[model samples]
Target: MIGAALLVFGLTLVLLLSIHAAEARHPQADFAAPLSYREAQAVVVAAQAREAHLRTVVSQPLGSVNPELLPRMQTIYFPQTGHHLSNRSGFLDFWRANGQLQSFGYPLTEEIVEHGRIVQYFERARFELHAEYIGTPQQVQLGLLGREILEKQGVPPRLDEAQREGRYFPETGHTLWGRFRSFWERRDGMQLYGMPLSEVVEEDGRSVQYFERAKFIYFPEELPAVFRSLQHSYGYPLNALYEVQLSDLGRLLAEQRGINLAPVPQLEGTHTWHPALWERRVEISIGEQWLSAYEGDLLVFRAPVATGRDGFNTPVGDYAVYYKTPMQTMSGCMAGECWNVPHVPWAQYIVGGVALHGTYWHNNHGTGIRPSHGCINLRLEDAQWLYEWTSLGTPVKVRY
Candidate 1:
């Protein structure tokens, strides 16, 4: 096996050297240009900087590229293209020059073996995704979701209010049209996929979290296009598309290339899970509310207790399971009435000092809609079992 690998390596070296020498003779062929002493010195500096930039991209899971692939690439590959590759700087230069499936990260044939660089089926040329979605990663989701929504249900024409002059409504009226007058006028007709823009947020005003961190994937959104249209009346596809989140897909492909994931995502540990490994996560609807908890992703224990009757509503947010104490004492009342309560062994999650433990004074466990100072109260034994089973950094997903 070693001998065979050596032969392949030697052959590849010869091929690449021949390409370079031949290109130098021709003065221009692949990517680099001729170098005088000044240009050579500049090339050396530029090469180092370009390498640093590719290292950055390798470090991140952008699009379908993997984080693990970054380390392998850094260790194995050497940078040659210094300047004259598109005038972008740093990571942007790497992206413009070498990171595409069609351009630099060229797809490899079976005969070609990349010792460290990411060699995949992807041709390194056709990566136009970067050009289309550049400002923020969120745009990828919007573009994909919008196209999916449109494909499933065709675009409705803009709305026309009969009351407005010079604006006409079609006889079929597929699109709910609005007047193009003032910003405030008839703007109500335009909606995202079918949901009114006003209802984009919940009553409490927390922007809806589309990506669920525990699963490292986007929570499935309903098929707005299919559900609303006659084209999808039978609903052939369950969801408009089996959409993968921008980060998740990239992380998945990186793993396939024998890449070494960083600190938290190490291999051969007591617990090692990548976002790509999960098949499906179950969504548990405990009460009238929907909150997600993955089976292997987290451990859950429920308890009930008394809460504020009036002003002190418990704010909801995501937190990590920090510590679980066997027995602790609760002294000072939240209402400023001091009382030392002993024998409270709470399972604590340190997202704003909240806990899930047994309540000695109250029997109702997270259901009667009673308010407390944000700590969950449960029976003593359940608390013990949960504390035993849960690992540090396990997430607690609580929503109503």
Candidate 2:
């Protein structure tokens, strides 16, 4: 009986030791077991909860007019941050590849049509989709935000040593060749023109360069007679001289930014107009530097005027006041002569970009110095009077 009892105790002890050995091998609950359906579902739901943090962008229609032209929906993914964005179409990829993710950030809104062109706004940049340039190299382009910003600040980018000596600015990607290199250097490079704001843009069949204070155009094919002769005699490149004319861009630029650099003087009250004011007419003599405003041949106002100088001669023709603004910003440049006058008050655009406006820069209106680029310059009060008196479509005759 004692032997049998001892045998039973030894077997029990061995069983206890085996159980301890198995527990030591595992040390914890067995995780290798296949999860049940409920457990698997919980795991999946947790993963989805994490992914739900990614932003989902939605694209809205620019308008009902061109639904067929709308871009198909697309989602963008940033693997590094595990952030997702949608509705950017190819712009997201383009932005990523072009290093605009940090500079421009994400899209503020879906693509929309602006000024008859498809455009998308980002934080620091505006992406213009030139559908008209489909299949061309310019299908996508950046707006002149940098230029507009610089013009607003009245401070442009600084130039490097090469740019100071009149070379293409490295900041402009070197596409804007030093077309006005010598001219810009000779005519006060930094203090006068600021830096080149834009690359050479083809507008109205001519290449144009926008400077902070001026605009220069390229007329390579048709050089003016004087410049043509200079090209023949002195081997001067007319391509860089006569063909390149100064353009008036201040008012237009200001309009684009929706901020007036020059505010018009507000009249105390609306002035009563004379019945004859409806028949107001203006006459300018380029050679005499004179302007005369008349009502039915009865002189209403006469003022000494400054016309365009030499190469920037005022156009001699018949025109009418198509548009009149209270204030305008005038800017132009060509060769060695350039002018960027901001906040010009009392402007009446006669034809093209030429206007009769107040001139605060110089007091020599009646003087023989025809310092104006093309527009006629008047004294402050005279221009204000004319601006108030003149009517749109008023006939203007500019001669000699």
Candidate 3:
């Protein structure tokens, strides 16, 4: 009986020892134990460093045009604003293609990760990178800085719904009237400035209306004294101020955040060409009956065009606009056909007697039915816009 009892005690001691050995080899996690303050700070620093490295890798151009050539990115430096724009996070391209300095102001910060997305601040805009749309043009988007600013200042009491007039927008419960509406339509405001956030309200002795992207302020006295002096010095039109001007909300916000405005040295990807950097070019596709206008390589406008039909085909060649007039009387006879056209609006002579002119007589443009007698026919509005957009010596290409 004593030997049996001693054997049981020995077995129990062995089992306890085995359990401790197993625990030493594979210990349980101490999830409840808090990290030390120093350890926690080190973890945060490591995470930030990793994010910065990832951003750098993403900003780099993927491949070169040739194995021998190094991949080149594009960066633009604004001397006036002492700011540089890197092609990081698609900011530089968007800025150039959109409105450049006029619409977005200068870059206030380099691309930085904000709320799990990359963003860069401009004087008047905040560009957010949508990684999901990386390859598309919509990858970068403008933040609702206008709306945000208005909210912080305390949004004015909502206007009575019944009293709203002049091109009302139900989306934002705002009315766009007077010169503001005209400017909005002319400038393609929906894409540029976004929806109006408030009706015209007096703020700091100025009439202002807030939009999702911008704040429009009415200049009752027309061009301010500073602008008038600039106009006089530069021979610029005073009306360019347009009675209503965009407030410098971008700059305002950047200052509020205490962002570093000092300019940095131009980066390695400093020299690359984009459509915005080139002269205006127009291409006419004879086969497609289409006209496309480009600023450098960027296609800014396109419209249907009626080229010469059959034997009176449009001369397919590269030409430059040597002469242009808003209104002209075109009288010509070709291939047993005579046309005595009166008041040909927006006539731009490209080669010999062949010109691009507004056609009121025919509505068939891009219907594959070319009816013009050698001249390229365009709709009145299209012709007018093209006429105003192009200057003398602008390149024009007519291709089959």
Higher-lDDT candidate among 1 and 2? Answer: 2
Supply candidate 1's per-residue lDDT for 12: 37
Ranking by lDDT: 3, 2, 1
- Native-referenced Cα lDDT, model 2: 0.53
Candidate 2 lDDT tens digits, 33-56: 123323433433343233222211
The true-versus-predicted C-alpha distance at residue 256 of model 3, in Å, is: 1.5
Q: Pick the candidate with the highest TM-score.
A: 3
Model 3 is weakest, by summed lDDT over 10 consecutive residues, at: 25-34
lDDT (Cα atoms) of all candidates against the true structure = 0.32, 0.53, 0.66
Better of 1 and 3 by TM-score: 3
Better of 2 and 3 by lDDT: 3
- How big is the positional error of residue 148 in model 3, measured in Å on the Cα after superposition? 1.3
TM-score of 3: 0.55
Candidate 3 lDDT (Cα, whole model)? 0.66
* Candidate 2 displacement at residue 256 in angstroms: 56
Question: TM-scores across all candidates?
Answer: 0.27, 0.32, 0.55
Which consecutive 10 residues in model 1 have the weakest lDDT in total? 208-217
Looking at model 2, which ten-residue stretch has the lowest summed lDDT?
A: 53-62
